[model samples]
Target: MADRDKDSSAESRRILDRIAREADSSGSSLVSRTVKRARDHVSAADVDEKDWVDHLGTRIGRVLGLVICVGLLAWLVMFLVRGA
Candidate 1:
């Protein structure tokens, strides 16, 4: 074989060996993947239906209270201004 053919054959074998090793693995040997999984788990919400309902109820209650407070303040201002 020629010198160029020999060099190309060696490079082909090196690349094939690398591909075989990567194909045989579980593909999760990277620390970045593990860290990403941990970060996703930490930031994930574990809320149930009841928790969602409770949160919604709390928000609605606050909005209702704000409306009531503003209404009462308006009424008080009117009462003082009208002197009645």
Candidate 2:
């Protein structure tokens, strides 16, 4: 049991170290990485190629989300400017 625990701990450390090294090598800022991930998600890059309906739905959803975000931001700005 003790040996197993030590082995698991060592494995976890190695995985973390590898991940840190890869991240350093990638040299991408957190914001860029986040944007890339978001773009990929909105584009449904991971969705099945055969699922056209799902792909269309994802795109529509992303567009709606963007519209909603923009609308909310506009409303907030107006509210702040008008002192409401």
TM-score of each: 0.40, 0.72
Q: What lDDT does model 1 reach? A: 0.72
Please give the distance, in angstroms, between residue 79's alpha carbon in candidate 1 and its true position after superposition: 0.5
RMSD of 2: 2.6
RMSD of each: 19.7, 2.6
Per-prediction backbone clash count? 0, 0
TM-score for candidate 2, please give it: 0.72
lDDT of 2 by residue, 34-81 (tens): 999988887888788699998889888987898899999999999999
Error of 2 at 5 (Å): 6.5
Q: Pick the candidate with the highest TM-score.
A: 2
